[model samples]
Target: MNDPRSPAQDPDSGSGLADWTAGAADWIARADRIAAISRPATEILLARLDPQPGQRILDVASGAGDPAFSIAERVGSAGSVLATDGVAEMVTALEGRARERGLTNVQAQVVSAESLAFTPGRFDGASCRFGAMFFDDAARTFGAMATAVRSGGRLAALVWSCDDRNPYFTVVTAALDAVGADPVEVARTVFELDDPEEVLAACRGGGWVDARVEAVGFPWRLPDTRPETLIDTQSELSRKLRKRMEGLSADQIERARGIVAERVGQLEAAIQDGDDLIMPAECLALSGRAP
Candidate 1:
């Protein structure tokens, strides 16, 4: 079973930074695949943020620069986006991607969400996608974001809804359990902020007013239905699961891998898709206004 601690108490918040730093290169390599899967949620967040031309936007925990780059395009040359991540490696990757795309309007920086050291009201809008749930101090981080935005500016965040509603996460947990490997630690942190009300309360506590939550669901479509592809992709994407597998013996690891393959095979048989597997994913999009 997973732990029942609140988001603030979970140690993964700190470890998650280290994990992301170590996996930065892998994430960069798979950035396009991830971006495609997360585009729907990004659209939801952008709609809530309501960014406009000639405006400055702040993207906190901007991993591989998905919405940041998207926002940069939306804002055009007249506006700018400051993409900040706590991990320097992530920032470096983001910079590389921005440069490759010739995005002069997007700037990457190594800034922690809890310690956003920008001038007061420096941004017209801010966003954080799939990053809020891993925050060590949600209220403090959100408050810092609020401080950086002007009055009435919007703040939008996207977080995972729950384990059951997210097949991408549950599949791995089920695989681990099937092989008798403990998945409690990984499961605990991934869904820490699954509750929408908790996100609303945190935003309100951080001085963001008129906070509301919306549910966003999308299909995480993969081009291949192969079990090996699923296992390899999930292993690369989930740092906690990868780290856990690293501690297991070769036989134990093989057992878990086999379980994942079996489960994925079953899914393939049930779905009967010719070349693709579409996993259902759900996220909570929270929007609020700065005080």
Candidate 2:
């Protein structure tokens, strides 16, 4: 649900983001909620990157430009970021956001990681958040990124850890299973690459060396959000449930909503901050250096 290719660099744009094309609206709508929940990981990502002024950075899978525009702010006017994704709709949303923020140094486009057009050693460093797990081929995806970065520049990101430690993902998912809908297949789950060894192998296969993996986790915060707002942002649940209830009545939607609310309430009752909720989560903060 993230990242973009540069519109100005249409020559490099590809159609690899079909998976997210129709989901663009959902991604944009959920961006803010996602940000609040993911801040814990993003904080660690930025710390490890320590992006410098005047550095050319690449923000891959920069959906709604999470750390991309945020990085653009840190790099200031001297540095720029090429935020890219395979979905044009997602890039369009990012473009709107950049304009709203008056970010002249940031650019969004429909670029695929499989077809990066930059020259070797083109960037000072790169960043990707949760986007790595969705790639069709993780190794080749990172390899392309490595080929584009300068030596000494590192790529850092936050990836979901195992499901057991990240209950925010599993709690709601388990609820759906209890409701008789099959959960997303484990192979297709976002935490598929939770294993550090798998990540290390991907880094090495991608021409990135000196890799490091660090634990970074936090609660799924409800900052400026609530159960209803949070519910709409649940991608896995919304998507699967929508298909499961395709021909049902409005009553069915309402019933499903009630079930989710009850399930979520029970899971968070112990940790609820009045109306605010905090769900436990686990993630890995990783870095890979260009050779």
Candidate 3:
């Protein structure tokens, strides 16, 4: 029996959800830039969802309005898409993006995954990308999502398969190590939990019935090979990390720079005579029905 309570209230929580809420606010101000980097993968996931007209969809942790706005297009004027996140900044950005797109079908709200205010069986379907893993209790968090959908409604979320499968973090970490930064000493705050069994168990614990997990593999391309890219990569984590790193010694900083430079050179070599620097990213797409 999972308690349906807001996970955000837990201060000592080990889950990175709290930090993500704050960090995402900062990220949304630069939403267009972030959206460009992740747009391809978002398109792939939405294509699979194929939301239909008249369907009421929920875009949980809808950062920067990409997924929600995308859903709005599919649902059209009759249907609606509720875009939500625990961070107010994200909600503000989402609303701004919706307004800019002239999308009246989308609404933004500040909501947490561990607890949702919507009535049970309220939604036709729901989807989240790279969001569920941040919960303090993944099982409790997903259980809430399950309760929000109608009996026949669908739920889907995307998470990393494992650390090694994604170069965005692994390559950058390797770069930090190349310049003499201790691997173990590096900020583990941006923790990525990708165990298939753990994820499945969480979904089941959340009252999801007949949940299915699919692997989505695609190339993640970064346009630039500069030190700025390294900073952007770190931004993908959290500001807490950025703040912590800001205190590092000049020599240590230089080492980190060298590591990133080496990784960039490798990526440049891997580029296939084109502007796109595609690197592989493996995602686990989990879908299930509400009981």
Candidate number achieving the greatest TM-score relative to the actual structure = 1
lDDT of 3 by residue, 244-278 (tens): 45556777776776766566566533343254455
lDDT of 1 at 226: 52
For each candidate in the order shown, give its overall lDDT on alpha carbons.
0.78, 0.72, 0.70
Please identify model 1 stretches exceeding 4 Å from their true place. 1-15, 182-188, 226-229, 243-273
**Please, what are the lDDT tens digits per residue for candidate 1 over residues 90-194?**
777788899999999998778666666678899998899988776777888888888989999999898899887786777766776666665534322658899
lDDT: the better of candidates 2 and 3: 2
C-alpha positional error of residue 275 in candidate 3 after TM-score superposition, expressed in Å: 3.8
CA-RMSD of model 2: 5.0
RMSD of candidates 1 onward, in order: 6.3, 5.0, 4.3
Candidate that would win on lDDT: 1
Error of 2 at 84 (Å): 0.6
